[model samples]
Target chain A: MDTFVQQLINGLTIGSIYALIALGYTMVYGILRLINFAHGDIYMVGAYAGLFLATSLGFAANPSAFGFVVTLVGSMAIAAAMGMAIERFAYRPVRKFSKMTTLITAIGMSLLIEYLFVFFFEGKPRSFPQLLPNDNITLFGNATISTSQILIFVVSMVLMVILQYIIYKTKIGKAMRAVSFNLNSAKLMGINTDFVIAFTFALGSALAAAGGVLTAQYNPKIDPLMGIITGLKAFVAAVLGGIGNIPGAVLGGLLIGAAETMVVGYGSYIGIPSTYRDAVAFAILILVLLLRPAGLLGSNVQEKV
Target chain B: MNWVKSIIVGIIAIAILYVLNAAMSATGFFGIGIDDYQSRLLVFIAINVILATSLNLINGFTGQFSIGHAGFMAVGAYASAYFTVTHGKAIETSLSGLGETVASSIVLLLAIGIGALVAAIAGLIVGIPSLRLKGDYLAIVTLGFAEIIRIVILNIDAVGGATGYQVPGYANFLWIGIFAIITVVVIHNIVKSDAGRALISIREDELAAEAMGVNVTRYKVTSFVIGSAFAGVSGVLFAHYNKFLSTNDFQFIKSFEIIIMIVIGGMGSMTGAILGAIIVTLLPEILRLLPAIQIGETTFQFADLRLVIFALILILTMILRPQGILGTTEFTDFFKRFRRADKPTGGLE
Candidate 1:
C-alpha cells in the first residue's frame, strides 16, 4: 500500500509535467489544427534557456525561491517569442497549403531546432542548477514527498491557474476560442484571427517552457535530444484526452503518467522490463487511436463525405 | 513479336549490366566490387532509390502520409538476415558444386524475396486498421507502430536485442542493381496501371474518390503493402551491405531520412524520388570533402554541422518550394511532350 502511494506520488509528479506540455499541444491543435511537432523542442529550448539564465543572471550563485521564479518567467518569455517567430516565419506562409505541408514544415522546424542546439551547445548533457533547496518531506511510513516534486506541482498549478484566468477572463482568450471554432467565421466576426493564432502559440510555448524548467528542477540532468520522446508522449497524452480539449489534455497527461509509472514499478512481476517504458506510451497511443479516434473527451463528428 | 522483342531487350540489358558489374569489380577502376568505398556508395545509392521510390508510392502517389518506412525495413532486415544467417550455409553446402557466385547469389535472391514478403505482412498489420484514420492520424499511428517494433526488437534477444546480429553472405552491387531495377520497374508499372489511377484519385481527394466508388481503404492498404515490400527489399540489401544487423539502424530517424529524400526529390515523380535518393545519400559525403579549417587557431569541422545544414535545408525548402525540385514533372515528361506535339488528341491528357 505504501509502495502504491509512493508510486502514485511519483506518477502525478511526472504527469503534471506531461500535463503542462500537453496543454501546449492541445492549445495549438485547438487553434491551428496542427500537431506543432516543434512544440516539444520548445520545451527543450526552454530548459536550456533557464539553464542559461540561471547561470548568467547569477541565479546559480543565489539559489533562492526568487531566483527560481525569475528564471521560470524569463524562460517563458523567451520561448513565447520563439513560438511567435516560428509561426510568422515557418508556418504563416505555408498556411495556405495542405495540412501535410504544414506538418512536414513543423517536423523540419523540430529537426532544425534540435540540431541547432546540438550545434551550438554540442550534445553534452548538463546538470541544471538547483534554485530552490530540496529535501524530502515525510508524509507517512514509506511515503515521503520530495520538495522538488512539490515545487513542480505547485509551479505548474499556478501557471495553469494563470492560464485559465487569461483564457476565460481575457479578450484574447475569447478571440482564440473563436478562432479555433472557425477561422473564417472568426475573421468575419471581426476577431483578429492571425493575432489570436500567434497569441495561442505564445501561450502554449510559455506553458511548455514552464514545464521544461520544472522538469529540470526535478531531474537536474538536461540534454538537447530530451524533448523528442517526452514531447511525443505529451502528444500521445493530448490525443488520449480528445485532442483540442483543454481539461482532457490534463486528464490524459495524468493517466499516462500514472500508467507509465505503474508499468515501470510493477511490470517486473509480469516480465515487463522498465526499459520498455518508452514503448508503453506508443502502445497506449496505438490502442487509444484504434479504440477511440476522437479521444476520451472529444465528441465524435460524422466524417464529411 | 512485340513481346518477344521486349523480352530479348530485357535479357540483353541485364547481361550488359552484369558484364559491366563484373568488369568494375575486377578492375576496381571501373571501380566496383564490395571492397572499395565508391562501390559501397553506389550500392547504398541504389538501396536508397529503392526505398525512396517505394515510399513515394504511398506518400506521394497514393497521398497517404506514412513515416514508418523504417519499421517495414526492420521487419525485412531481421527476417532476411535471420534466414540467411541460419540457412545460407545449408544452401551453399547443398550446392557446393554450383560455384560460389551462383550459389550465393541464388541464396541472396531467396533471402530478399522472403524479406520482402515478411515486410509486406508487417505492412498489412500496420496498414489495414490504420487506414481507417484519415491523414495525420494514420501517420502518427505508423510512427508509433515503428517505435513499437524497435522497442520489441530491443527486448527479444534471439535477434541479438540491443547488441545486434552478425550476417554473412554479403550481397554485392550486381544483385542490388538488379533488385533496384526491379523496384523501379514494379513501381513505375503500378503508377501507370489502372489501379494506379485509383491511387492518384485517392491522393487528390479522399471523399471525392470514395464517392466515385473507389475502395479507398483497400487501395491505401495495397500501396502500403507494395511500398513496405520494397522497403523490405532495401532492408535485405542494407543488411548485406553492412554485414551486420542492429535495431538501432531502423529507428524513426531513418524513416525521416527516407521521407526527406522523397520530399527533396519530388514526391509523386519517380525520377524525383530517385534523384532525391541520390542527392540525400551523397550530400553528407560531399560535405565531408571540406578540409577542417582553423579560424583563430580554433579548428572548424563542417562534418559535425552536416545534420544542422540538413535541418536548415528541410525548413528552407518547405518555405520556398514545398513541392520539391521536380514538383510533379517526371523526366519522361519531356518525351511525353514531344510525342504529344507529334499528335493532337493525346494532348488533352
Candidate 2:
C-alpha cells in the first residue's frame, strides 16, 4: 500500500513536468498544426540555460528559495525568446507550403539545434547544481518523499493556473484560440494570425522551460541531448490527451507518467526488467491512437473532401 | 508504346550498371578491391532504394507520412539474424553441411525466407494501428514506435542487448543484387497496376478518392504493410551482410536519413529513389577526396566538413528543387521523343 502511494506521488511529480512540456506541444499543434519537432530541443535549451545561470552566476552551491525562483524565471525567458525565433525564421515563411514540407523543415531545424548544442557544449553529461535540500519528508508509514518533488508539482500547478488565466482571460489568448478554430475567419477579423501564432509558441516554450528546470532539480543531471526522448514522450502525452485540448494535455501527461511508474514498479514483481520503461510509454501511445484517434478529450473535426 | 519504351530503357540502364560495376571491380583503385567497394556501394544503393521507394509509397504515393521504416527493418534484421544464427549451420550440417553438397543451398534459402517472413509479420502488426491515424499524428506515432523498437531490442538480452546480434556472414553481392532486382521489379509492376492508380488517387486527394469507390482506409493499410515488408527484406540483407548488428543502427536517425533520400529523389518515382539513394550515399565518399587544407596549422579534413556541407545541400535542395532531381518523371520519360513541327521557312522560300 505504501509503495503504491509512494509511486503515485513520484508519478504525479514527473507527470507535472510532462504536462508542462506537453502544453507547448498541444498549443503549437493547435494553431499551426505543425509538430514543432524543435520544441523538445527548446526544452533542452531551457534546462541548460537554468544550469548556466545557477552555476555561472554565483548562486550558492545550495540556493535559497529566492535564488531558485530567479534562476527558473531567467531560463524560461531565454527559452521563450528562442522558441519565438524558431517559429519566425523557420516555420512562419513555410506555413503556406505543404504540411510535409513544413515537417521536413522542422526536422532540419531540430537536427540543426541538437547538433549545434553537441558541438558547442561538448557532448558529455553535466551534473546539475543542487539548489534545494536533499532531505526527504516521510508522509506515511513506509512512504517517503522529497521537497524537490513537491516543488515540481507546486510550481507546475502554479504555472498552469497562470497559463489558464492568460489563455482564458486575456484578449490575445482568445485571438490565439480563434485562429486555431479557423484561420480563414481569424484572418478576416484582422487578428494578425502570425503574431498570435508566434506568441502562442513563446508562451508554450516558456512553460516547457519551467518544466526543464524543475526536471533538472529532480534528476540533478543535464545533457545536450536530454530533451530528445522527454520531448517526444510529452508530444505523445499531448496527442494522447487530444492535440488541441488544454486540459487533455495535462490529463494525458499525468496518465502516462503514472502508467510508466506502475509498469516500472509492477514489472519488477513479474520479473520484467524496469529498463523497458520507455517501451511501455510507446506501447500505451499505440494503444491510445488505435482505440481513440480523436484522443481522450478531443472532438472530431471531420476530414473535408 | 510507352510500356515498350519503359522496358527498353530499363534494360539499357541495367546493362550500363553491369558494365560500370565490372570495370570498377577490375581497376582495384586504392588497393582495396575497387570492385568490392563498388559492389558495397551497389548494396548501399540497393538497400536505400528499397527503403526510400517503399517509404515514398506511403509518404508520397499514398499521402501518409510514416517515419518508422527503421522499426520494420529492426524487426526483419533480428528475425533473419535469429534464423541464420540458430538454424543455418545446423540445417547445413544435417544436409551435408560438411561436404560440397547442394543441400547447403536449401538452408540458405530457408534463412532468407525466414528473415523476410518475420519482417512481414512485423509490418502487419505496425500497419493495423496505422489505419486509425492521419498525417503528422501517424508520423509521430510511427517514429515513437520505431524508437521503442530500438530501445526494446537494446534491452532484450536474448538478442545481443545493447551490443547487437550477430548473424552468419553469408550474404554477398550476388544475393543482394538478386533481391534488389526483385524488389524493383515487383514495385515497378505494382506501381503500374490498378492498385498504383488507386494509391495515386489517394495522394491527389484522400476524401475524393474515398468518394470515388476507392476504399481509402484499406488501401492505406495495404500499401503501408507492403512497404514495411520490403523494409524487412532489406533489414535481412543488412543483418546478414554486416554480420554484427546493434540496436543503435536501427535508430530514428537512420529512418530520417532514408526519408532524406525520398525527399531528395522524386517522391513517387522509382528512378528518383535509385538516383537519390546512390547520390546521397556516394556524396560522403566523394566528399572524402575534397583535398584537406590547413588554416594556420589547424587542419580541417573534408570528412569533418561533410556534415555541414551535407546539411547545406539538403537545405538548398528543399528550397530550389523540392520535387527532387527527377520530380515525378522517370528516367524513361526523358528519352521519349517530342515531335517538332518544321518552322515556316521565310514564307515558303
- The per-candidate TM-score of the B chain, in the order shown, comes to 0.92, 0.86
Put down candidate 2 lDDT per residue, B17-71, tens digits, no spaces. Answer: 5655555556534433455666787788778877877787778778788988999
**Candidate lDDT values, in order:** 0.89, 0.81
Pairs of residues at least 3 apart in sequence or in different chains that clash in candidate 2: B25-B35
Instruction: Please report the candidate that would top lDDT against the real structure.
Output: 1
Deviation in Å, model 2, residue B318 alpha carbon: 4.3
Give TM-scores for every candidate, taking all chains together and pairing residue i with residue i: 0.96, 0.91
Give the poorly placed runs of model 2, Cα more than 4 Å off. Answer: A60-62, A270-272, B1-39, B93-108, B287-321, B337-349
TM-score of chain B taken alone, candidate 1: 0.92
Rate residue A25 of model 1 by lDDT: 92
Per-candidate clashes come to 1, 1
| Candidate 2 lDDT tens digits, A1-305 | 99999989888888899999999999999998899888988888999999899988766476788779888999999999999998887777678878887887777777667767775575788878877766799997899889899899899999999999999999999998899999989999999998999899899999999998899999987887788888888988998999999999999999989988988888888876888888777887888888887789998787654
For model 1, the superposed segments whose C-alpha errors exceed 4 Å read B1-16, B26-35, B293-297, B340-348
Docking class for model 2 is acceptable
lDDT of 1 at B137: 76
